[model samples]
Target chain A: MEAEAARPDRRAERAAARRRRDRRGFAIAAASTVLVIGGLTALILTSSGWPAVRETFFNATVFKESFPDVAKAFWLDIRVFLIVEVAVLALGLLVALIRTSRAAAMFPLRLLAILYADIFRGIPTILLVYLIGFGIPALANSDAEGSSTLSWLPTEPVVLGAIALTLSYGAYVSEVYRAGLRSVHPGQRDAALAIGLTERQAMRHVVIPQAVRNVGPPLLNDFISLQKDVALIAIIGVTGEAFQVAQIMASTDFNYTPLLCAAVLYMAVTIPLARMLDRWDRGRVR
Target chain B: MSGTPVIAIEGVTKAFGDRGVLRGIDLEIAEHEAVAVIGASGSGKSTLLRCVDLLIEIDDGDILLDGEVITDPAADPVAVRRRLGFVFQAYNLFPHLNVIDNVTLGITRAHGLGREDAREAARATLARFGLEGREEESPSNLSGGQQQRVAIARAFATRPRAMLLDEVTSALDPELVGEVLRAVRDLKQEGVTMLIATHEMGFAREVADKVGFLHEGRLVEVGPPEQVLEDPRDPETQRFLRRLLEAGRA
Candidate 1:
């Protein structure tokens, strides 16, 4: 007779052992994390400059005092960022389309687009900002001969800074868009055309939609960089943005806490976006 | 057989640089006839189909759709393609569009069917291909067989004069291949004229009214399925069939 009720099941016993092993693993991981992190904390706390560093860089008073002004200036940053982002997206797609088109009439424009992407993307973004912020106004206002050319150009540092950012980011984003366009299999174009869509309609409806989807993660990545690099405008003396305002407050009292406040503000927007990008990537991959 | 051929190719030639792909090929598909071109991987079967659809411009000669020469400089390729249905080997369904949109794009945009009518037409076509209730799903979310079925539905929705199938079953899994081929067989039941470039010898024997053997950019043999597959007169055709038998595909 098989007295199964009296016997211990092998599967049950194995599952119990697995549960024990998992618990032990988790405990070990927790212990190691505590030991390493606590050791580092103790060492940093014992450093000789800890007291002074805490007062200037991590002071609660300065952060509170500068938070309002930094937040106010961040609005300007937000406005510039939104405007520049829209301009960059449009400009990038235009350049990529011109470069990819086969029209003989587009030859000159295609050459100009190629050079624009190459030159703008090659230079550091801050250098472009500095040159445009100062050079354009100087050239437009007068010459050594006192004969001005293109005098209608805006002299505002903010406008010039926005333009510089758009040009630089547009170059990088255009390359991203071009790669997306090329990544589509040639068979796709054939199938689209075979369905009776005109070449223009094919690009607009079938080709571009898929191309944009293929490069979404990289495109968002470029926008994130564009967000953080908004601070570079401060180098051209656009002092209304958060980073510049924070720097001014920090310099007045020799307290670095206002800079920390600005960093936090930037992170507030960028970190959520970065997390969303990660999730979007996971969805696409799955 | 009594009227103009649905598609006629006369002395068609195409080349990519010094390498010629389709060299002086002539073929015809009469109304309601299914013509299967059997060939090795790069024997210009696909090139032939693409040339007929005007996806790839011919280097010489002319192709006629319903007795109208389409290769003339004045002929509009877009309008010509709108009158033909071409299915690719890779099932090139637009991944961004759902099944319904993929089917309706041609009907609405090219045929000028109203959106509501186009969608109803797409639904009916998809249902015929056993793809009903899959209208909202992305092509990427589907199996390879289901995707190819959707592609066929998309092409058939516009009700073109002839269907060009370039190895539609070649990219499918072995088990899934039967479903897509069954869909094609159903199209035959509707009396749709077809030109298929395929490697399935059994399918060619079952469905094609005539079989053409292509070898290195030329049609080496053309006859009834029995004469070509069973008793090919050309030595090249015999050798090709023997190779297939050795590989257990025949």
Candidate 2:
């Protein structure tokens, strides 16, 4: 009698399990269908018989002819990368210190840092670079004949690109630092206060070191993003670097191969750093 | 409450929003005296200890330390906090700092001690706490008991006149609690006045020179261990004591 009673219940349980499995299968099928459709759409759009794309992207002539100029462009990109990286780190740290300070005197400075970050981050980087490169010079040298602050700035495209990248990237980097500061345990600050360390002393000795360690992975990811964003400077007619070399080749040969090459170069720089960040994040979890 | 009370609380009340957490507490601890505050959760014992350390600002009244009004409206809170050390329940040692650096940080940074002198002081404190060979190890690498001891050492390294211990041993496991309590007991013997908010009835009964029972933000009873723990005068005190004993059994 007990076995007979349990049989229907077992049948119901089996039915529920079967239904769940069916639903899951349906969901997987729908997702795969969407993915396949999207992939096909992308392939069709990018591989449409555009002569520029076929000749410049696939043919070897454009690459060979532009190799030297592209090499110079890549070197310029490196210079921009180094300069922006260093500037962002230094300025970000400074902004973090200001934001964390308790002194009433620093309140205005903190407000200014916030304003700088918000304004720059909200606006397009190209606009800021254009303003700095073109607008600032125009404003500064309106009185002088063929002389401006742009003259004082390095004439080389590499130097111009570095300055533009630093100005835009530094603002964004400050927010990363602020997030790091917020991640530090409040108890750490209390511990420092309990020990009689002044606010500044505690921040320097206790808080910032731990915050930096905690935010390491995100900061590295940001660096990778910054690497890709460096290409934006090429829009300002700064050529002979990675992105610019591609642009020069694309314009001359009317093909997309150099652009593809630039994409590959970007992936090369970012992919390893991305993997390292993933490993770091996994280690933190463990 | 003789020999110039090291700490004097006169109608000290603390509140958050509309709720009164510490309702007009008046207490005193004589120099070198160990006072253990026993209470259930939300009794404001921790708040009172923080008030003494000036870690939490009081809403009303005064906290006098060394016979001076440390919590006076005009007094420098940072300066007052300098003379009072605090050990937290969670052992809030700087994770980035090694044992020695953790102990010597305040001495070197706040007290302006020479690095060598600060290190020597740190070494001596670590040795006192039986952490002689573990100076270079990060606090995270140490056991809970060792980390608490290091925290105690760091607190005592500055030679504060009084230390606020907020449920210091409450977070440790049963096996680990004794080691941390032992460190506190050692500090007591060495004349470090402490205001400890604790849940360990046995330790409170044994080591505390005076014990105060706090129930619902009020000090229901205050007396020596025997009077407060064994022979309570108040009904609330008896009930609290009973609950603690029953909980311990369970």
Report the poorest 10 consecutive residues by lDDT, candidate 2 chain A.
A135-144
Model-by-model DockQ, in order: 0.84, 0.74
Return the top candidate by lDDT.
1
For residues A1-286, could you state the per-residue lDDT of candidate 1 as single tens digits? 3798778799999999999999999999999999999999989999999999999999998889899999999989889989999999999999999999999999999999999999999999999999999998887887778777788899889999999999999999999999999998888888889899999989998989989998999999988899999999998899779999999998999999999999999999889889989999999988
Worst 10 residues of 2 chain B by lDDT: B241-250
Candidate 2 residue runs with Cα over 4 Å from true position: A1-55, A60-65, A96-103, A144-160, A254-256
Model 1 ranges with Cα > 4 A deviation: A1-21, A142-149
Per-residue lDDT of model 2, residues A1-286, tens digit only:
9888766787779999999999999999999999999998788668757555566576677666665566667776767787789988888888877877778998899899888888888878778777666654455453437655545545555556567777678787778888889999898999999999877777889899988898899789879988888887776667666987777678875777777777767787889999999999999999
Report clash pairs, candidate 1: none
**For candidate 1, lDDT tens digit of each residue in B11-116?**
9989999999999998999999999999899999999999888898899999999999999978889999999999999999988899999999989888899999
TM-score of chain A of 2: 0.76
TM-score of chain A of 1: 0.92
Error of 2 at A175 (Å): 2.3
List per-prediction Cα lDDT, in the order shown.
0.93, 0.84
